[model samples]
Target: MIETIVFDVGETITRDDRYWASWADWLGAPRHSLSALVGAVVARGQDNAEALRLLRPGIDIDAEYQAREAAGRGEALDEADLYADVRPALTALRELGVRVIIAGNQTSRAGELLRDLDLPADLVVTSGEWHVAKPQPQFFERVREVARAAPSATVYVGDHPANDIFPAKAAGLRTAHIRRGPWGHLWADDPEVAAAADWRIDSLFQLASIAKG
Candidate 1:
């Protein structure tokens, strides 16, 4: 049985419109322009960070993120940023006696912001705090450690195929491919990646019905 259900934050549990809007400010591009660029990057199966760098050379992602946080504007996900189904789905999973964790690649202060929001996540960890990012085996191992559950008995849910599903599966965690967001939607039709997921969900609302501890 899966005793823990860990979710990817941005675009998985968090809708992330605010973050992109910030990116728009940094690029001095309209929000729609940034969104379109992001879509292009996703459609090409490219890394989001790398694509941003390619678009704006010498862009310091971390520095900008810190500056924004210092100004109390860095957290991309606000109360309004969460998907409508996130809280309900998370609460339902918690009621099943499963440990629910929200872990993702985010600024160092992301956990602090999320805590204030008080989402149902039992634990929230960020790559900034953990000193590692996803698609790296160590990242998932840290999550495994924090979860206090065997990797095989844990479920890793996320919208990214290369980052979340593949790496989590490699780490012996069952993977759920959520078919939303750029990464998820762009790759949803890919035969190989789609075939690999232990679970495929259209929405977090379906999580309670499918992921049983």
Candidate 2:
């Protein structure tokens, strides 16, 4: 039986529209242009941040992040950013006695914001806190360490196939490919993604049944 359900932050639990919009504003680029660039890079299998680099050649992303924070316009999150199904789905899963966790590649500040939202989760963590991001074996290792459960009993759900499905599956955890974000919709129909994911869900609401089964 699945004893734990771990979630990816962006697109899984929250919409990333605000995230990219903020970045576009920071870079003084049109929001639509940056959004299009993100999709383009993702389609080419390049990092989405590459869009920023494309906009400003040789840009130091970390330094820019710090500058944005100092300017009081850095990463921001709130209840409004959450998906409609997030609360109901996570609550339903937890009510079923399944441990729910939110883990993803996000900044430490994003982690703080997520906690502030007071979502119904056992723990909220990020790659920034662990100093390790997904698609890395160590990241999943850390996840297993925190979960304190057998890999087989844990489920990692996310919208990214490369970062979430493939790596988590390789780490011995069951993987669920959630079709909700840019990456989610783009790769939802890929054969490799379908093969890697133990479950393909259109909404978080489906997790309760998966946890029960």
Candidate 3:
């Protein structure tokens, strides 16, 4: 039985993949290429701050950099609304006896976002909090520790293949790739993504059926 479900806040829970577009414009790289680049950076053990520094000049990394700064200072910015139906989906999952945990690189931004949505999650595992992001095995390992979960009984639902899918698979957790928000195109084109994910759902609501199995 699945006792815990790990979720990625941005894109997966919140409709905020717009950061990718900002990233692309800031880095002057193609949006898709930036997706792969961020994956490669994480794979190489580089921090997001260092990655931003290495990126070319004239790119406005301000929004992202500012958000991180705000998080560090414990300030909340109203970027936009968290994804619609996120509260309902989370409430439904909890009703099914599934403890929901957030696993992402978001600093305190995710927690603030969830709070703003008025939805309560059981646990939040963040790279900023843990000093690592997904696709790196340590991210899931840290999450498992925080959630007190056994890998086989937990499922990670996220949108990124390199970070979300591959690492969760390696961590012995089932992976559900939800493609609809930002990185929707990345999910469509990433070759390694399909093989890494155990299940693909277009929406969070679909997890109810998949988890039941």
Per-residue alpha-carbon lDDT of model 3 for 1-213, expressed as tens digits? 777888887678766445655656644677776666555665564544444555564545557568546656333324364666676777888889888887787875555655565555887556776777666777878877766668877888887676677778988887888876545444544667778777788878887776677
Please provide TM-scores, in order, for all candidate models, with all chains considered together. Answer: 0.92, 0.98, 0.71
lDDT string, candidate 1, 102-133, tens digits: 99988677878887889998898899899999
Q: Give the CA lDDT, 0 to 100, for residue 191 in model 1.
A: 79
Q: How close is candidate 3 to the true structure, as a TM-score?
A: 0.71
Across 153-187, the per-residue lDDT of candidate 2 in tens digits comes to 99999999888999999999999999887899999
Off by over 4 Å in 2: none
lDDT of 1 at 96: 88
For every model shown, the clashing-pair count is 0, 0, 0
* lDDT rank order: 2, 1, 3
Q: What does the lDDT come to for candidate 2?
A: 0.93
lDDT of model 1, residue 75: 59
